[model samples]
Target: LAAGARGLLVAPSWSAPDHPARYEEWVTGLPVPTVLVERLGVPGGPLDEMDRVRSDHAHGVLLAVRHLFGLGHATPLLVARADSPTAQAVRAGYARALDVMGLRAPLPVLDSSSAERHPVLFEETARGLADAVRTGRATAALMHNDEDATWMVRRLAELDVRVPGDLALVTYDDEVAALADTPLTAVAPPKRAVGRRAAELLVERLTTPGAEAEPRVHLDLLPTLRVRASCGPPTSP
Candidate 1:
């Protein structure tokens, strides 16, 4: 309130805990225009009327997994933050994709809170994935974010596991981080466009106070899958 910010644009860090709640509270009690980028299930009280844009995690995950399955991956595990709605949606998409192909299984899930606390966990996850590949358990992995996928890929390489050759990897968010990696494959979210649209909606509400519009606005942006080199044809030759 003290700062001279005309409008507030809240883009919560996906890696942060309690980001959803923090975002919810941040938008509360503020008269200025506000925009938020959040997952599903974040409470949108009167603020629901506010202009917001969200990434369609479910669709993004499903598209990526479907592509991997089309390429011959059988069992795909979903990796995400523990107990996140985004994770749940991604998992649902994974299951739906598998079910569509009639190859769905009880896939493994790995959740590590905050990348900072799980430095070693990435390596462990890579080892576990390698074991799965060796034992013919899992053939591909779907990560919640590009960071997790990148870490898993590096770790797998350290373990002498060849990407796409032995195991396939996929992830959400094709930001710079994902593109910087070798053979990066990711589902890119329309972040800037989402922010711009959300901002425009908030500005409209601010300029037209008490307009006869609903109190909440829910916007869903489509995300696309970007295939890269980390994943490959199924190892059935």
Candidate 2:
């Protein structure tokens, strides 16, 4: 409150599962006009109420699930951080996509929290993941990020398993995915556009605080899936 700041663009995601959401408290308490990135609005509510530059993660996850299923991979195991709001949203999208596609059996949402804890993922975690795949009979897996995909591939290699040939993989974030040994099929958001839009919103709010018809823009940028070798060739020979 004492800081000499004009405005703020925050990305304080929602709470963990079964936890209370604190967006309302934070937004109400902030002194200046603010905008939240990625996600920052209630359902069916006014977009201008809280300026934002949101990413449509739900739809992006749907595209990933559909892509895997279309490529003849039936069993999809979703791996994510247990406490991330983004992960929770992805899980919901995964479930919705499967249901809409009429898939009778629901896939598992694996916990990859270990990825964030130990800067370097542990061996036991990898072993446990491999075991989970065997136990769950998963043919394909979606990682929370490209880093997890790389870690899983290395761990699988140690266990004499190979990606695509053994377990097809898809990951989020295409930033560094192409550099992976096998290259990764990833979902990439319009990162630059997102940042630009968020900044623009803050600038607009700062410039016009009392205009009755001021613009209230809430954009949900669409993300694209970058296909590569990780999920294998699109068609079988």
Question: Model 1: per-residue lDDT, tens digit, 118-205?
Answer: 7677656666778877777777777777767766666777787777777787877776444646767888877787877877877776
Clashing pairs in 1: 48-215, 48-216, 48-217, 49-215, 49-216
lDDT of each: 0.69, 0.72
**Residue-wise lDDT of candidate 2 within 1-237, one digit each (tens)?**
477887888777566654324345656467777777876445554423677787788778878888888888775777776566677777777778677877743345666754456644446556666875566466677787777778778878888667877677888767788999999899887878898989887887778656325666678998899999988532332
Best by lDDT: 2
- Candidate 1 has an lDDT of 0.69
| Model 1 stretches astray by more than 4 angstroms | 4-6, 12-26, 42-49, 83-103, 112-117, 177-181, 208-215
Report the lDDT of model 2 for residue 126.
67
Relative to the true structure, candidate 2 reaches a TM of 0.82
Residue-level lDDT for 27 in candidate 2: 67
| TM per prediction | 0.78, 0.82
